[model samples]
Target: MEESNFTEKDISTVETSILSSVEASTVIIISVTWFDTRLQSIQWFGEMIMLIFITGLSIGENKVADKGKC
Candidate 1:
């Protein structure tokens, strides 16, 4: 099998980035829903975007972790 070049530091950096994105998205979502109740479509769109972003991040995180495991 080919060896992976991903180091512990690299994995940590990726995880940190993903976590930060998740946190930022969550905050934005909350702020939009709480402050602007009239923009229902915008709120739904934002929530959908956040969900997709989080799902992509989760898949990427899993791949990184799997590489580290090798």
Candidate 2:
């Protein structure tokens, strides 16, 4: 069995990827919901939640980058 060795750079890469993916997904979701009036009632709530999550991810990514861990 081989053991996986993960470094801070690797972790930073993963976090960055996740942050980008989530940001993109949130944009797509908002755009999709924008054109569909039927889902308007829940759109704001969903987008708010996604924005909060994206914010947290951005904060974490920024901290990692600032700390020179990547």
Candidate 3:
């Protein structure tokens, strides 16, 4: 087995990027729900938006993880 060589700076950078992405996603989800509620006719649209965002987030995190392994 080989030892990993991740530095503190590298970890910090990855953490910051992840946190920022999550924070922005949360804000967008909230905004979309708020608007959907107001529209009334498109109330179900909020759920679809939430699903799309969650899927995108997962794919993005995977790519980030892959990059970190290099």
Candidate 4:
């Protein structure tokens, strides 16, 4: 098996991708909440935001692992 090596630039790219995904998710969540009347938008937004944060943290941890820093 061939092992691929990633440079610092690769790690930065991953971080940027994760952040962009989070931003996209936020926009989707907002649009959904705005379109729903019965649903509690605040609660949904908060939960989704928390999920996004957790996902970002996990991605960051993975990046650290890839860098052999943890």
Candidate 5:
């Protein structure tokens, strides 16, 4: 088997994709909860947790990018 190499650009692309997914999921969850009051609290909490995780990941990714390691 051959090993594949990933460059900074590749890492950036992956980070962007993950961030986009998180944003999209958060939006969808909030929208659904907004229309369905019964799930509002749960959705809100979930969104908060997800946002924190995403923010942490984003920060880490930025640091890696700053180091030119992606």
Candidate 6:
């Protein structure tokens, strides 16, 4: 049998990919909900907007940190 050890680089790559996937998923969910009649309320709309805004800022912060590390 063979065993493998994950390096720091591999971990970083996985984290970045996971973060990106989450962001994309959030966008899709928000879009679908936006068009769904069940979510037709100003309060629900605002919450979605806030969630997206926060996610955007978090992604932006990661990018900045990556730049600083380079």
lDDT of 1 by residue, 1-70 (tens): 9989976644566567678777877777677688863547877687678678778878998898899999
Which residue runs of candidate 3 sit more than 4 Å off their true CA positions?
1-41
Clashing pairs in 3: none
Between candidates 3 and 5, which one is better according to TM-score?
Answer: 5
Candidate 5 regions with alpha-carbon error over 4 angstroms: 1-20, 23-38
lDDT of 5 by residue, 1-70 (tens): 9777954544566577677868777667676677763556786687677778777888888788799954
Q: What is the C-alpha lDDT of each candidate?
A: 0.74, 0.69, 0.65, 0.70, 0.72, 0.67
Among the numbered candidates, top TM-score falls to 5
Give one digit per residue, the lDDT tens place, for model 3 in 1-70. 9877965554454456556666766776687677653435455466467557666766787898899999
Instruction: Provide the global lDDT of candidate 2 against the true structure.
Output: 0.69
The TM-score measured for candidate 6 stands at 0.44
Candidate 3 global lDDT: 0.65
Candidate 5 clashes between residue pairs 3 or more apart in a chain or in different chains: none
Candidate 3 TM-score versus the reference: 0.42
Ranking of candidates on lDDT, top first: 1, 5, 4, 2, 6, 3
Scored against the true structure, residue 41 in model 2 reaches a CA lDDT of 52
| lDDT, residue 42, model 4 | 88
TM-score of candidate 5 relative to the true fold: 0.50
| Weakest ten-residue segment in model 6 by summed lDDT | 6-15
